[model samples]
Target chain A: VGPGDDAAVLSTGADEQLVVTTDVLIEGTHFPSGSRSDLIGYRAIAVNLSDIAAMGAEPRFLTVALTLDQIDDEWVKGFAKGIAFCASKYGVKIVGGNIARGALSLAVTAIGVVPTGQCLLRSTARIDDDIYVTGTIGAASAAVKDGVKVPPLELNELWSRRVDDMSCRYFMPLPRVQMGVALRGLASAAIDISDGLMADLGHLTRSSGVGAEIELDRVPVWKSMDAEIAIEASDDYELLFTAPAKEAERIAEMAVRIGTDITCIGKVTAGESVAVNGEVGRIDSPKGYRHF
Target chain B: VGPGDDAAVLSTGADEQLVVTTDVLIEGTHFPSGSRSDLIGYRAIAVNLSDIAAMGAEPRFLTVALTLDQIDDEWVKGFAKGIAFCASKYGVKIVGGNIARGALSLAVTAIGVVPTGQCLLRSTARIDDDIYVTGTIGAASAAVKDGVKVPPLELNELWSRRVDDMSCRYFMPLPRVQMGVALRGLASAAIDISDGLMADLGHLTRSSGVGAEIELDRVPVWKSMDAEIAIEASDDYELLFTAPAKEAERIAEMAVRIGTDITCIGKVTAGESVAVNGEVGRIDSPKGYRHF
Candidate 1:
C-alpha cells in the first residue's frame, strides 16, 4: 500500500534497529529572499540525513511535511524535483507525509536502519580517545554569509564563478553518510557538525561524561577563514567522532577509501569542560545560527 | 541511548511491521489567531496519531520538528507540557526531533506497529461491502469556523458553555485507535476522515477501483449541522471503513464496546463514480482548506 493508505508499512529484519531523526527549513529564516526552492528542499532533507549518518545508520526512508503560504506551480514543481533528486542520491524512499497551508517551510523525518548493537552513540566516547573531524569546515557557513547578495550583471567572469561556487556550497551540503557508516565499529562516539564543529564536540563530551582538548592549529578550516570563526560557524554538516588511538590508521584508511580528508584535531580527557588550544575557552556562538 | 544520540533506535519484534505517517500544524492556518499554544502542541501529535489508528496500528514513537518565529518562554513551556501530556495519553514516546527559528509550525512523524500482512489497506474494499463511519462528523469543522471569533466577556452562561464545548472539540480530537485496532481483521478497507466524508470516500473508491452510493439521510451529523455541510466539512478526524454486509452486527458490537457510534451510510459498488442520495453528486470544496 502506498500514498492512498493512511500509513506506510516497513518490514524490518529481527536484528535490525530503526534510527529516526528530523529537521526543518523555513523560507524567511533558513532560505532568505531569492533562494532557490530546489536547494530549500535539498537542504531540508540533507540536514536530517546528516543526523542519521552521525549514528552510523543506513538511510532507508523519509517522510516530508511541507507547508506553503501560497501555491505557485513552478515553485512546487522545482521543490518536488529537488526532493526526488536528493532522495534518489541517498537511496531513501519517500514513505508518507502531510502538506498544509502556512509559511513556506519543510520538515523531514528520515529513517535509517542499522544492525542491533552497532549504532555509534555520543555517550560512549572514552577518555584518551582521539577526536577526528571529516572534511573541511566553515565553507558552507562562509558561503551563506556571502552568497545571498545579488551581484551586478556586469560583474567580471572570475568573480561570478567565485560567487557561483560559494552559493553552491551554501545550497547543497554533502552529508557524510558513507564515512559515518564506515566508522560504525571503530568510533566510540560520534556527532554531526550541524551546530558548529566545536559546539557539537562540546555536546559529545557532555554526553560522554568527559572533556575534550582541541588543537586549533590542526583544525581543517576553509581557506581565508579564521580558526575562531570556523569553530563557531554552523552549517558544516560533517562528522566529528572519537575513536581509540590504535584505530587512527584504520580511520585514515577508511577516509582514503571514501575520498574525504579526516584529521585528528583533539583528544578526550577527564572532566566535563571543553578546552580549545590548551585554554579554557568554550565554543561561543557570536554570530552563529541558533535553532532555539 | 535516547535524546543524546544522533537518532533514536526502535527495536521491533520479528513479525511486527512498522507503520509511519506524518502531519504538520501551522499557527496561522491550522489554528487561527487566539488558539491556545498547549492545544497547538496537542493537536500536532493527535492528528498524526489519528493516521496511525486509521491503519489499525499501535502507536509507538514520534519525532516532532518545531519552528518558531519568536521565542516566548511561557508559550514554549506550555507547548512542551502539552506534548508530554499527549504522549503520555497515547503511550507514545517523543523520540527524536529538531527545533529551529522560523514561522510557528510543528511537523510530527509518528511510528506505529502492526502485525505483518494484516494492515487494513485502503485499496482492499470489495464490491458490495457496506460502508461505515465512526463518530459524529462536522463538530470539529464547525468549531473551527465559529471558535475563531472572540466571544464578548458579557456573554450569557449558556452561550458561553456552548462555545466552550465546540472549541474544545476543535482543539482536541479523540483518535479512534482502539476501534481501529479492533477492526483490524473485520474491515476490508479503511481511511481516516480528515478531508471530509465525501472527499475521503472518493479516495477510497478510487483506490479500490470501485464506487460508493451514500444515503445522506443515514449519515451522522453533529447537532445543527446540515447533511451536505457535514459531508463536506473537513477535520472530522473519524474513521470511514468498509466491511462485508454480514459483518454489520460485528461492527456495531465493536463500536458499542469502544463507546462510539458507527453508522452504515453507504455501500460499495462496481463502478468509478460516487453517488450521494442516488444522485451523481461529487463533493466540491468551496472554502475548504487546501494544502497545495
Candidate 2:
C-alpha cells in the first residue's frame, strides 16, 4: 500500500555491494534485423556481463531495456530464450526488463556485488607488465569479410567449432568468468576485448597511467587469420590483460587450470603510448566504438 | 573474478519490495530538443512514478537508460537534475543508469517492492465500482494550443511563472504517490493518465474483462477547458481508478489530504467498450505512443 509514500526503502544487505555498469546495443550499429534473436539477446547480456567481468565481479543480475519495432511474438520468444540461456549459463537472473516500441535497440544495466576491494579495474596495470590475451583474436573481424559464412546467426555447425572465434565472439564473447576469478589477485590490470586489441589496451594504459609496447610477433593469431587481418580485426571478446612478466608462467598456468588459452602479446611500458610492434603500422590512433 | 562468468549479482536484501513498473519514453515522439532538459528528466521519472502509483506501489529505486544522439554533459546534467528532484521529492534513489548513443530515446525501468500481494493492478476492477481521477485532466492538451509555459530548464523566472499548460503536462506529470498508496486496498483497478482518460480506462476494463460507462457529465474538466478539449487531450498524469462507491469516497479523501484535487469521472459498466456519451465522442483512436 506504499506506492506513493514519502520515500522508498530497498533491502540489499551485502556490504561489499553493487557492481554496476551500462552498455547499449543498437540496430544497424550493433546488429542487423536479420540477425538471430538468440544472438542478439546473448550479446546484449554478454557485453554487459563483460563490463561486470572486467571488474572481476560475478554477474548475478540484469535489467534489460528492449526498444522494438513491434512485438514480434516469435522474435521476442527467441530473444527471451537467448537472454535466459545466458542467464542460466552465468547463473544470473533477469529480475527486470522493459518492453517498448522504438528503433530496434537494447540497453542493459548489469549489477553485481563482490567482496570489498576484490574487484579488478583497468587502472591496476604497472610498468613492465607482460601483456596477454585470452583465447584467439581477429576471427570476428575476418568473419565479416568475404566468403566467411558466419554461422547463420544461430548456433549451427559452422558456429560450434569456432564458437570461440571472433565472429561468434561478436555474438557470444564468453566473459572470462573463470579466468577472471582465477586471475583476480594475480593479474595487474584487465579488460574485455570489445574494441580492437590496441584500443582496449590503450584504455588500460590510459587508466593505469602507463603505456604499452605490444609485440606484434608475440600476439596470438588464429589459423584462419593472416598477419594483416590480425592487426586490425576487432570484436574479439577475449581478455587483453597486463601482468608482471614474472607472472607469465603463472598466468599461463591459471589459464590452463581455468581450461582456457592465454597468450602473451606484449609488455606494459613506462611511457604513454599503445604501440603495435608491427601490426597495422603501430596503431598510434584510438580506433574503438566512439559514442558521439 | 569471473570476468567472463555467467552473470553478476546485486543484493536486494530482506526488505519487502514496494513499486515495480516499466515505461519507455521515446524521442521526437515524447519530447523535442526544444523541450527543457530539466522537465524531460522530471517528466521521465514522474511518468514512471505514475505507473508505480497505478499499482499502488511505493516509488523507490530507479534505473535509467539514456540512449543519446551525442553525449552532452550539460544536457544530461540538467536532465538528471530534473529526475533527481522528483526522486528526492518522493525519496526515491537513483541507483544506476546507462548511457549509450542511439536514435535518441530514454527508457526507465523503476522498481519498488512492497508487501507481496498488496500491489494494485488493472485486473482487479469489478463492476458497479466508482470511477475517479486525480488532478485536472487535459491541461496538457490545451497547453499545446495555449503554449503552456514550463518550469525553467535553467533558473529563469520568466519561464517559471509563465506556465505552458500543454508542455507541463507533456513534460512534467505528478504521479499521485500518496493518493495511490492510500487507495491501495480500497481501489480496484487503477492506471495513470498517459494515453488519455478514455484510453487508459479501456486498458483497465480490458484487463478486468469488464465494460465501463463513464458519465460524460461527471467527467472532470478544467475550468478553462471545455468538453471538446477534455475528450482528446492526453498527457494528464492523473490516476484514473475504479472502486466501490463507498471506497471511492476514501480515494477522494486521500486526494484532498495530499493537497491535490480529484473528481468522480465515471462508473464501471458491463460489456467491453468505453464511451463518453453523445456530447463527447470516443478519444484515442490511434492510442498513446505507438512507435514503429
Candidate 3:
C-alpha cells in the first residue's frame, strides 16, 4: 500500500486487513481562524475517517497530533470533547496522539479494518459502470463561501442532532462509513467527495484507466444550491463510487436500508477524460480545492 | 492502548500485536525555525521510530502528515528524500500521508509489530529492577544548545554514515530498533528519552508505581558534556529501560553483540520519587522538558 489512494491497506495475516489514512488540517488554511475549537477537532477526525470509509473499511481507531499556539484550558477542553464525540459516534477508539506547542494545527491518522481480499480501490472501476454518490453535496463548500458558523451546542446534544442542517453539515460533515461498507461488494471503485465530485470522480476514473460522464442535474445537491457549485465544491464527505449497471437497483435498496439517499449521477466511459453534462456545460479541466 | 506511554499497543487477535505512536514537530518549537528541511524531516520520522523502538517492537510502516509554509519544490524534494532515507534505513515502509499549507510542522505515526504476550510496557517494572540506557545520551541536546549545524551530504551518502557525530545525532538520531528487539524478552519496562532522561524515567517509575535512584557517574553521557545537561536536556531519542538485576550481565553481553553500548544507569526503588546522587547532589524535583 502506498500514497495514490485515500488510505493504505495493510495485510494483517488474518481474516481482516487494516486500512490506514492520515490528514492534516491547519487553522486559517483548512478552517477559518478562531473557529470553534470543538468543530475544528470534529472536522479533522471526520475528514480522515472519510478516507477510511472511502476504502470500504470499518473505522476502528484514531490518533491525533495537535499543535496549539497557547495552552488555553477551555479551548483544550472543548477540543477534547469534540474529538471524543466524533470518535464515539463512529464507534472508533482514541488509540494514541500527541500535543505540542506551535501554530494551531491538527493531524489525524485513522485506522480501519476490512475483510481480507475485499478492500475497495479506485483503480478497479470498469468502463460502463454506473457512477453513484451517497448523500447531498455542496453544503460544506457553500458554508465555507458564506462563512456560516455552526451553532454551539451542549456536548451531549451533539449526538442527537440531525446532519441535515446546512451549517452543521459544513462544520460536522459525517463520514459515510456505512455506505462505503455497503458498497464494498457492489461498487467497482470508490472515493469520498472531499475534493469535489468532478475531481474525485476524475481520480477514480483515471486510476481505473477509464473515463466518466456525469449528468450534473442528476446530482443530489444540498437544498437549493446550484448544480454547478455542487459539482465543483468539495468537503461533502459523501461517497462517490462506480458499480455495474446491473447492481443499481440493489444499491438503491441498500441506500434505502441505510437511510441515505443514493444518486446515480452518471456512467463510466472509455478514454481518459471526465465529461460533465447539464446546464453548466462541459468542463475540460478538473477544479476543486488545492493546497498549493 | 492510549496516550500515557511512548506508543499504544493494539492486539491484532493474531500472535502479533501492533504498536502505534505519533509525534509532532513544529518549526521554531521542536527545531530551529530555519533548520535544514531534510534534517527536519529526518528528525521527525526518527523521533516517532524511537517510540516504536521503546515499545520493543519491529517498526513496519510509517505515515507522515506535513504542513509547509509554502510550496517550495526543492525544499519538498529534500524533505521527501530525508523521509525516504529514514524509512528505508529502518526497513519500514512509507504507507500513507497528507500535506497541507501552514506553518512548517511534521506529524508522523509509526506502526510496529511485537509478539502479543511480550510487548514491553512502562507499568510492569519491579522495584529492584536495574535501569539501563542504550548508546550515549545528551549529545543531541548538547548539539542543539551549541548551535551545531549538521553537514549536508549527498542523499546516498546518508545511508553509510555512522551516527556518532554530535551534529548528526542531533539532526538525525538513529532509533535503536535492533537493540529494542533484542531487549523484548529481557527488559521489564521501557521508554524513549525524548523529553530527557529524568523526565522520561519519572514517567516510567510513575507508571510502574515505583521510584528510581541513579548515580550520575554511571550514566553514559556523550563525550565529556556535563552529566547534569545529559540528565535534564531533551531529544536524545535513546531507549531507557529496566530489567531484573540478575539480567544485567546478559544485557551487557547482548549490547556488545549488537555493537551498541548499554549502560546500567540506576535501580528502581520502592518510593515514588527519583533520587539523584553524585556531584550533582540529590534532586527533589524531576527536571526536564515540558511542552507547555
Pick by lDDT: which candidate is best? 1
Question: Against the true two-chain complex, what DockQ does each candidate achieve?
Answer: 0.71, 0.25, 0.34
Candidate 1, pairs of clashing residues: none
The TM-score leader among the candidates is: 3
**What DockQ does candidate 1 score?**
0.71
Number of clashing residue pairs in every model? 0, 40, 0
Give a tens-digit lDDT track for model 3, residues A1-292. Answer: 1121111223244677777777888988898998888888888888878888888888887888889989999999989988988899899888776778999998888888887757678788998999988888899898788886566676556535547667677668878999888987998888888878877877777678888888888999989988987887888988888999999899999999999888899989998778788885775544432221
Candidate 1 local lDDT, residue A67: 87
TM-score of each: 0.89, 0.75, 0.93
- Stretches off by above 4 angstroms in model 1 are A148-165, A278-292, B148-164, B278-292
Model 1 agreement with the true structure over A187-247: per-residue lDDT tens digits: 9999999879877987888788898888887889887678878888888788999999999
Q: Write the per-residue lDDT of candidate 2 for residues B1-292, one digit (tens) a residue.
A: 2222222223344444434454567775666556667777877888888877777777767777677788888888888887787788779877667666778777675666555566677777888888888777777767656655664545233224323444556666667888877877888878887777776776778778787776666667765677655855677778888889877566667777778777777778877666566354653223332220
- Of 2 and 3, the candidate ahead on DockQ is 3
Tell me the lDDT of model 3 at B42. Answer: 80
Give the per-residue lDDT digits (tens) of candidate 3, residues B130-168. Answer: 999988888888888879666677655654553667877
